[model samples]
Target: MVPVAALAAGAAIILSGCSAGQVSQTADQVAAINGNTAEAGSIALRNVHIVFPGSGTHTNTAGGQAALALSIINTGETVTDELTGVTTDLGTVKITPADGDKIEIAPSETIVVSTPSAGAETHTTGETVDTEAGTTEAAAIEITGLTQDITPGLTYNVSFNFKENGTVQVEVPVDAGIESPRHESELSKSTTGSAGGH
Candidate 1:
């Protein structure tokens, strides 16, 4: 038997434990899953993953480029929000559609974007500012100037900016040889966004 006060406190701890990494995590888009599911406010981010450069289709410029693939779902029946900007600890972030013209997540609707060329890019001190792995959707954002290494299973933080919900950051997992089926495209085979949009 346990004291009522102690039991109550224990229960609180257990419940809060279930929400780990979610509290005060308004600045880490790199890790977005508690068993492959994460959320902020009324928006749930699912199957969130990041890809690094390797041989073949995944060959990015080492410390050059990376991309994020995930689905955004709005859980609220009447709530709506816009995905504005994206940022990573390794570099700068830019989103397509932008804030004023951002990708809107309607109530209970999931939006998927998979186009690396227009997605996110990680740049090194290369002559050009282009990413090797390019895929983006829902207003892709390119990350320029990478200051860290991108390797498989390596985790980093990316802050996702959203209208009406501010910024929600999560630690994203790096999958070396994995690319979302939807994100894989013929455009990825070519060196696109050399103009600096990669």
Candidate 2:
């Protein structure tokens, strides 16, 4: 039989070793972000996510439209980049800038992309912020002709192409709000009501 002291020492070693050689999942070690993030050259896409088509828990049907929201940040100190186009296998992306044909991101600047308002198509709104670094513009992004159903808790692949940064493919998820059980139940009721109305 093993001695009591040896057994106690072995248990202590095992317990201490459990935390060794493992990465910490605490907030200090990893950032708590709601959306996915990706990088393309000096440009970084933050909070990349797709908006659910409707308020209900029902999934967006195939060939329906959804909105993509993200912020494009140019980390370069001097080099400027232009977002030329965005594409996805699930659908075609339409980017509308408040001004200009392409969305421009000046050095050390950020451009925010948000979902279009209800009953509006290709909506873009932003204010010109003239800073010492450069001007920042806000744009709107919409994905149309989606070939697959878009539902909460699912991720879809989308590619963003920049004139200088090239392209970066990001797997984006649906909005985080609908992920909650309470929100899901609310959506179910609303979806049922809408279906009965129509």
Q: Tell me the alpha-carbon RMSD of every candidate.
A: 17.2, 8.5
For residues 1-198, could you state the per-residue lDDT of candidate 1 as single tens digits? 469989999999888776466564564565534214567888887766665443324333344555566667777778778887787777766455422456777676666543354223322211122223222234344555566666655567877777877788787776544354545677666565566454
* TM-score, prediction 1: 0.54
Error of 1 at 79 (Å): 2.0
Work out the TM-score per prediction. Answer: 0.54, 0.70
Best by TM-score: 2
For each candidate, how many residue pairs have backbone atoms clashing (under 3 Å)? 27, 0
Question: By summed lDDT, which 10 consecutive residues of candidate 1 come out lowest?
Answer: 124-133
